[model samples]
Target: MATDELPDRIAEIFNGSTIFITGASGFVGKALIEKLLRLTNLRKIYLLLREKKGKAPVDRMQDIFNNVLYDKIKSLKPHALSKCTAIQGDVSQINLGISQEDREKLKNEVDFIFHSAATTRFDDTLKYAVIMNTRGTMYMLRLAEECKKLKLFVHVSTAYAFPREKILYEKAYEPIADPQQVLSSLNWIKDEAMQEMQDKILGDIPNAYTFSKSLAEALVYEKAGKIPVIIGRPAVASFKLTSSEFINHELATEHVRPSPFAMMDCRLPVFVTFCLLRYPQLKCLSLCLRMHIEIY
Candidate 1:
């Protein structure tokens, strides 16, 4: 579609809007940033990035855009890259470890927020997972409450957060434990003690990832007072590699395994639809999962 022929409704909603995104370097976050730049007339995108391996946030941001994922934007709309700015921060830290100037700027100018940063490792320690997923959500919610122009706060959660339910619904489920109490315990409980009680704390949730995500959802339900919130529960998302040549070469020596459950295509449309649409009554959005015969 021609730029002039872009849909008016989407354009009207996003034109000149300023967005703040955590986990901008992750799979979903990168895809969402690409879509916003390629499809919307948004004015700015602030990415929260932390230093790693001696590289500054700006350097990491450059590395992300250099990936093959941003090739289309580079050729078609290179100027869009200029709108993205990296703010130094870590979600696991208090105040997100963001500078006061940057925090104030976000509070004054940001219109939308996408909190997608979390430790996704299934084997991660319960303490680290809670700090990253549960308490990190609390900090984001507090910041969302202070945003002067905030219109929406989208929290990216997992479909399997409540795994005990055979059929998951598009609504919040009771967390395994109170999020506040969980956070408090982390302060006094030793790592060995937490590890010993892991089975009891997780119950049937499976791992730290899902268990922390469940608590995050509960925290959002309890604290998101007046703020417009949407909890997106996306199920096992993966890319379907269509190029035969790339696949053959890439898999020549690699072992590929089939995903146990149905997968959802991790595409721009999935994120864009839920993030940009102004549906006040739509509190929870769950992506429909479909079976894919191809093994990755």
Candidate 2:
């Protein structure tokens, strides 16, 4: 396919597909939704979001529609708003904390799932990380299996899942700790005990975020033969040429790591991996960039 025909070809697969996206309120998740809603006219996008502090998912999504980023969506297809639906759910909980009715609605109809909800905090305790990142993924996999019409389970993982080794490549890596052991122990470990074991548990791995993500990837890999799943290990995310928001340096700065030697003016690169047999059309990009940098 010609380079110009690539996007359209990639979009064809999702033209009528039903997509369930977790962590839709997150930075990457939001961008994924914007592209889907604007480009392909996806059949339905079930947004799995935790009811924030007090607001319901619908209210939160409405607020999203009002944001400047969605101005293009509004102008393009004002009536297409009905194609989107927000459901209250938590990634770390069984059935995503959705009611039986809502769970059925998704399991029976959704075709693809993008799992992105994660506790990205570096200092998160092993217990919380296991619950949210490791166990949470197990639950998502179970849910994906229930989707009779499901075609793909796209998991958003981190490149640092392997840590800053001398060299990193486009292949799967194993986790340091026993994921099953850590998951089983989560129920019994107190918050304070987990906190104490943080350094010891993660070991050579950088932090709880990376450790949990690594464990989660292991879980997804272990189930590979039985399911159609793809793990996307993304590095740091920043502005893309097609992104709606003007490269907002201030907003993007918080996500970048802070280092004394880091350059402030370099662009990041992303590498994305996919299962060609399953999702032949879509393009995946894995992003890697400095922690502290200004984007133009």
Candidate 3:
């Protein structure tokens, strides 16, 4: 749906809510933030971003808002732009590296959360992937647990996380391995040793990224406790070079569907299509999930 055309159900769910998000600089994260900022009346959105390369998280957030995705809101719903705040944090760290003040504020005020940060590189080592994807998720869930008003926690994974399955199902399935144990073992292992043992550890899995993501989802299911958790597994889609190229690419394939909030609780999957490149002010879709989601 376009920003001006969000459904009542979605609007109602989001109205006046404070949302905390991880991986706001990534493809799906940008899309999700843009959609929420423009499509609804929200209280606030706190995006967790680590200070890196000498750029502060707030500076990086300004660059994100300068995107085409926020163009319409900048001109029309200008106040919406002000609702986005950047918090300095790293998911790979304990407590996500959030300051004590910020952490306490989020615990008391956040109404929703989205965890999208993960190590998706095929060449990434198991040790690194576990830290970012598996332990990162565990950390986010812990934070979500503290939120006094949390309604939902959305965890983004990949469709190919379970590569060995002939049919991809949407329910909680047993993870390939226990996430807690794997995370604990990272203390003594080097990246090289993990890489050498990757095949033996992953077995039928294709890559460290997918394998870690599966374990992350398992952690969410097993540890979310009272918080409603939705696992989103989006189908694989390559980055398109241009709008016409993206359209042409889409025409070349038919399996992809636009789905937003498909896995909210146990609700049936729903497709919600929105374009990532149409915004003239934005230059990247690296944070976009692009709606091809299967929620568990």
Candidate 4:
């Protein structure tokens, strides 16, 4: 559907807006691209893609669109994908490894950015995780700063970033460590040494993934400055909608919806959670075990 044909608020807001997205090959990125193509008539969608294995970035992007996730968009708007252009880049590298030509084009054309590139593996080495998640975020922020027409920068974070907190709020909480200090440590600390000290470094955080993400959030808080930014912390994203039979059977007998607090336990397989919260300046969407909490 065209943006003009859709009278919804979201479609109107995004109409004619040019967007740049990192992690365009990931699950969340693919889903976001599909939705924008299907629901909104955005002018352009620039995808930051890094070559992996033996394939090139453009080939990887083609494979991403070939997935079943985009089947709906293909049927709805066959030409919608023409708006998407793949930019060769690696988020873990300096300046996101984007060429000067591409960088200049992005700065001039992009109106919004979604920085969703990061390693989500729990077992990632501390050094690798910091370089990818924490430092990568800092680099993306610098790029955002250069975009003269940029309106909003959305940082995709994880809900488990602050595992120590009992009630995770929408606002930015203190990070586990100073991101810059941690990044600097990587220069002197070898990968093996970093691995040995991983547990000690993680402290309350369960894994390097969450720990690095926490530090990335802190970096954003410190460096966002005048940039219009919003942080979204989403929990485990299960692509398959298959429900646990045990949860269904138990809930059927009780005849009541699960409590929102059930999510805190992290034991239940299925439940809906609700919490009253307010984030005046920041917008966040927390999706945990089917629980959706949106604070704006």
TM-score of each: 0.86, 0.81, 0.79, 0.80
- The candidates, ranked best first by lDDT, are 1, 4, 3, 2
Q: Candidate 4, which segments miss by more than 4 Å at Cα? A: 1-6, 239-296
Residue 28 lDDT (model 4): 63
Query: Among these predicted structures, which one has the highest TM-score?
Result: 1
Model 2 pairs in collision? 256-291, 257-291, 270-286, 270-287, 271-286, 272-286
The CA lDDT at 178 in model 3 is 86
Worst 10 residues of 4 by lDDT: 267-276
lDDT of each: 0.79, 0.71, 0.72, 0.74
Model 4, residue 18: distance off in Å is 1.0
lDDT of 1 by residue, 1-296 (tens): 89887666654676799999998888678777877887778999999999999999999999988866677778889899999999999999987999999999999999989899999999998999999999999999999999999877888888878888899876678887788999999889999999999988887779999989989999877754568777777776655655565456555775864222211124433344444365656555444343232222
For model 2, residues 1-296, the per-residue Cα lDDT tens digits are 88875665546767798998887776666666766777675798898877787998899988766655566667887876688899888977765698889889988999888888899998877777878998989999988988999877778887788775556665566676789898878778888887887888777787788888888988887767666777776676544232224434324776763321111221111112224334444333233333222321
In Å, residue 215's CA in model 4 sits off its true spot by: 0.6
Model 1 worst lDDT run, 10 consecutive residues = 257-266
Q: Give the worst 10-residue stretch by lDDT in candidate 3.
A: 264-273
Supply the global lDDT for candidate 4.
Answer: 0.74
Candidate 1: C-alpha lDDT: 0.79
- Please identify model 3 stretches exceeding 4 Å from their true place: 1-7, 237-296
**All predictions: root-mean-square deviation over Cα?**
4.4, 6.1, 9.6, 8.8
Q: lDDT, candidate 1, residue 16?
A: 95
Q: How many backbone collisions does model 3 have? A: 14
